[model samples]
Target: MTSPTIVTAAMLAIGDELLSGRTKDKNIGHLADMLTMVGIDLREVRIVADDQDAIVEALNALRSRYRHVFTSGGIGPTHDDITADAISKAFGVECIHEPKAMELLAAMYERRGMEFTEARKRMARMPEGATHIPNPVSTAPGFAIENVYVMAGVPQVFQAMLDALLPSLETGTPVLSRTVRSPYGEGDIGAPLTEVQKNHPETSIGSYPRFDGKSFSTDIVIRARDATVLGAAETEVIAMIEAIGRSREKHQP
Candidate 1:
């Protein structure tokens, strides 16, 4: 039998405001959920300030290691918006005023009775040979060059760009997950959980603990690309939980 194809990606969030905690990041989680649905595993995420050198370094590193690199923020019309330039530097290409981008932004501004100012025209700049990623919410579009996708900082615009971008990209078999909740602490099932993981090497097992004011509980999630493997892993996890519960019951007075 042929092995399942695994598509992996990394994320780079660029902005000084993000690092300063002035603006909360919402794109990372949105991208994670959306990428999973399309069978692209988000393996790593990095946040860098709006510095050209920093963006270039992080972009190079991420694009080299992952199959795809999705970047958000810094692709705007302000001085700090240097994502496009940094991407150009990383790929050793020239940044230019892409004709399609200019046409779209010019028309939008004209329709709105707004002057196409130099700062606003900055949105038309893109790395050479990059394809536009449509921005439904705004006239300023994002771009995809090679494996890296440069998107907007705004949440609505980022999501809209992603919606437009996903269809054109290749996808693999989606990953499936099963959750088993138990009213026992993670500490109580640590050893058994490890054993279960060893038994099911194909599935990834994770234990998340939750506290509800008075009681502690855990949620065990098993994820795999194959349905049968996921089901078998879930069954073993349930059996481990039951055995632990029974052992505690027998020892209690």
Candidate 2:
């Protein structure tokens, strides 16, 4: 029998603007896809304000609940960027200034012929005993404290950090996925999909509806790790979808 390998992760999107809906959160979807690709399920996502208390509380809550905790936002040069400090306090570690980050900042300043003030040096601070997560787009970098990963708020920088950090993660067997499109609506296919789920208990089957020019159709997605099982389920799904399509085709003039 194949051993079960399902891991859970939590995402903490920090920033007052996101919580206030002043800025829409995009990190969650990216994180969800990336983590899922590595077979680590994204089980929880929380958006918190820039308040220190809120950050600390969210950190504690997420870390305790999942094997991996990923945090995005508020680690910039601005004063409102306090996620690093808040998380460091939550973990009882001092936020130390990293020499590598300082060097990077200094080099950037020199390259631009600008004075590297305390504000620029501000990017060097990270939690003590933390390892830097590389930013492919920018060198300011993020850090990882235990299982918690502190990432930048900028979408491009955050994506870079994830690319660097993901390879080092303890990933399970890659999840295999298949999607089948049906002209029929989700409600119409629900019963058959439920039967498919029952037959293959480990596989996850989901139905999503989309609108075309004239009508709406459902897309059935089945995901699982074992290739053989996924193939069997996929075959069943395709047959069902084709059957629906043919029926619709015959009905149309």
Q: Backbone clashes per model, in order?
A: 0, 0
lDDT of 1 by residue, 1-253 (tens): 2588888899999999999999999999999999999999899999999999999999999999999999999888989889999999999999999999999999999999999999999999999999999998997999999999999989999999999999888777889999999889988988889999999999999999999999889999999999999989998998988898899899999
Please state every model's RMSD to the true fold in angstroms.
1.2, 2.3
Report lDDT per candidate: 0.93, 0.87
TM-scores for all predictions: 0.97, 0.90
lDDT of 1 at 19: 93
Instruction: Judge candidate 1 at residue 148 and give its lDDT.
Output: 94
Q: After superposition, how far is residue 173 of candidate 1 from its true place, in Å?
A: 2.1
Candidate 2, residue 110: lDDT = 93
Worst 10 residues of 1 by lDDT: 1-10
Clashing pairs in 2: none
lDDT of 2 by residue, 117-221 (tens): 887677889988888998768678899989999999888899999999998887766678888877788877888778878988878898888987777788888
User: How much is 194 displaced in model 2, in angstroms?
Assistant: 1.4
